[model samples]
Target: MTTSPPEPGLHEGEFHGGDLDAARRRFPNAPAPWIDLSTGINPHAYPVPDLDTSLWGRLPQASDERALAEAACKRYGAARPDMLVAAPGTQTLIQLLPRLLPQGDVAVLSPTYSEHARAWRREGHTVREVSDLDEIGTAKALVIVNPNNPTGRVLPVERLRALAADLEARDGVLVVDEAFIDAMEGSASLVPQLPPSAIVLRSFGKMYGLPGLRLGFAVARPEIAARLRDNLGPWAVPVPALQVGAAALNDDAWLQRTRVTLEESGDRLERLLKGCGCEIVGRTPLFCLIAHDDAGTLALALGEAGLYVRQFPEHPRWLRFGLPGEEAAWGRLEKVLRPQGQ
Candidate 1:
């Protein structure tokens, strides 16, 4: 294999995580069955129920889609099930939101998800990457990733509520992406307290460990949700997605148990990384961010060793690792991080 530098995080859109196909191609000579620690997706996934043979042949019924919406509303503590709309994934919603809203200046609190800014810009809006809320200025729309991705920095609900109020005055919208909030402790979702001019997006895949299913939702005022529904047309969410998403959302025992498990796993990861001579910079339950002066070289080494982790181009010193699910996965990571002789 060539000893060139790696670009593991970039998919067609921009830099994010869990692109194993890109990883495998980048490190062609790395061993088979690479351990992906790129995204903040929960390693412990929700158990999917058995599907009927008929589900595949028949188109999803409107009622089944409604059931999924209700399950999501209850699961997220949304104001009303009618206020929710199911899409293929938050990526779809992320791209769709900018098109529906009046095109103008959009302020995204960054070093967060890159997709949010890119989506608005693609729709002909001036997008600004602001460091803090004070820099938002007169933007018509604001996007925030709650319990943020790599940094795991979370804003209080009150602060967010006040921001929503400020945007509402401008007839603007606040788009809060709560993709990682399921595993995030101490912070509450904005869905229940969803403001009049605010739109909250939820990712079922990240929390459920089934990003492949591509199910997600948007919680908003009834009119805004209706607008999204109209644009998306019929059958935006398929039958299997409806059935599986509803089942997963309603599983209380699994949800409660997983929350506890993720917290414990997060602490375990902290201990593991620290023991391996890495400094833990930030973390949510599903992933941890590390700061190393030589993160680029380290990332290249990890890539060569059949481990795919997220390395940000903008912040060259930062590296992000997702939780490894199984015991063997953890051992593989440890083996690579702490070689036998060391």
Candidate 2:
């Protein structure tokens, strides 16, 4: 495997979690069967139902897309079908929104997801990284990742609603990314109480643990949704994604069970980390962000042991751990982490 020097800035997009090939080069002699706990993706993915042969043979029909959107609305509690626009992924919408809207100042919550800032900047918008919601004054657009990535900070709905109201007066927009909210309970998703000036982005892959499927939705008012649909043009989502996402969304039983299982798994992870002398700073059920004085050293150590966890260059003291998929994976992680405590 080829190896390159790690890039400096967080925006390189070259150092995201779950790049097993990169890990292999970094730890070429570590071991076989590396345990990947880097990304927040659920280890237990949804079982995709079989697809009709016609879905593969022909172009996706308008009705099939409509059915997928309808299912997403029902599943996500959107006010109307027209309010939601399906796309290949939420990442696509992130890159598209800045171009669709008029150029203006965009404020994003910092030490969070880097893509939002990168997307806005790529489209020639002035981007500010605000540490607090109150610091978003006069910005034409505000982006927040609810149950935030890496940190898992959840903003209250009332605060977001008020922010939306304030932004609406200036004809600005508030974008909430709910990619990690599916496994979280009592989350204040902007979908149900979606404001006219606010657009909420949801990822089907994160929640369903099928990132390869590449399905996501943008929940906004009718007009904005229509504009996004026009920009994406026809047949944006694949036929397999439409059918699979619909089935997964409608499976309430699996959703409930997965939530419980993830919660238990999170608690188990907390115990393991704490037992290994790591400080648990923040988390969602899907992953835990831990603090260590030398996180880079620890991450390197773990990588050498064939256990990969996420480390943020922006925050030198932090490392994030995703849940192991099975008992063997969990055992492997525990065995690797035990030496750190010693």
Candidate 3:
């Protein structure tokens, strides 16, 4: 399988109020909507913790920024402090990776997040895509999305270690974007393996259901981390985001509860989709990837019935559903797309 990066025009939670507005204009008396499943986020979002008012007013400076990152390292079990860097979101770090590693050919595992390729190409670098890590060219920079975004595939850590060693031998960079690894059964995280040629990116958005809060981090070798810091510059994350991220990361009890919820929800999702004659492909306790011959039609029918699901343009046959919150939403979905013959 050959992997190319995600093309543009594809996004999680894609919808235009403009489109809805147009639909409303065409049919002003349409029924109101209830829930959205466009993005693979937990519908039972973690309660937004109340923050100190000072967090909103205070400007994030270098000292507080360092503290925030250091706290994250501890939370993730990283011993070295220099390996971590905080950013507004994982997207910022992915976008900056191309600029940071300017001189090499980049290879990305396919059916993964599109941002990786999009960022590289925008910086005038051509990216090679591969379906499996074995097919990836020995380019100076190799990027992989652990528990991959769209397909939800997770690569083994031992395989990544071997790959990293090979890349290091060629003076290459091995970037493991672990954006969704927090939800995996056993993550092949490279946090314990940070060095000059190794890097990992993590997102707090998907894990904590705080996408609007926009918190993420990158772990790399000391020198490489410094370079990323110098290039990306100061005020990397706003004070409020930093505060919330730190609080959430430290809340181990909450995280465990969230994981349990994800597992239960994912099981229900699998059964529900299968009941509708859809095939389950890849999944974690957090989200599931499913395929149908006509995802577009299914998406429209579901949306028209007041349930919004995400449809992919590049892979027209697939649809990704976020874990729904209530039995009512599930009931609505079942009513919208009942069993093949019942």
List per-prediction Cα lDDT, in the order shown: 0.85, 0.87, 0.74
lDDT of 3 by residue, 276-304 (tens): 87888888666788988766666656656
**Against the hidden reference, what TM-scores do the models get?**
0.95, 0.95, 0.88
Question: What's the residue-level lDDT of 202 in candidate 3?
Answer: 86
Looking at candidate 3, what is the lDDT of residue 229?
84
The numbered model that scores best in lDDT is 2
After superposition, which runs of candidate 1 have C-alpha atoms over 4 Å from their true positions? 1-5, 8-15, 339-342
Off by over 4 Å in 2: 1-14
lDDT of 1 at 180: 90
Q: Which has the higher lDDT value, candidate number 2 or candidate number 3?
A: 2
Each model's total of backbone clashes: 0, 0, 6
**Once model 2 is optimally superposed onto the true structure by TM-score, how far is the C-alpha of residue 229 displaced, in angstroms?**
0.8
How good is model 3 by TM-score?
Answer: 0.88
Candidate 2, overall lDDT?
Answer: 0.87
lDDT of 2 by residue, 1-342 (tens): 222223332112545787887788778898879887888999999998877778877777988888898899998899889998999999999999999888899999977888899999999999999998778879999999998998999999998999999999999999999999999777478789898999999999887999999989999999999999999999899899989998899899999999999999999999999888899999999999999776677777778889878877667678899999989898888887788788
Q: State in Å the error of residue 23, model 2.
A: 0.9
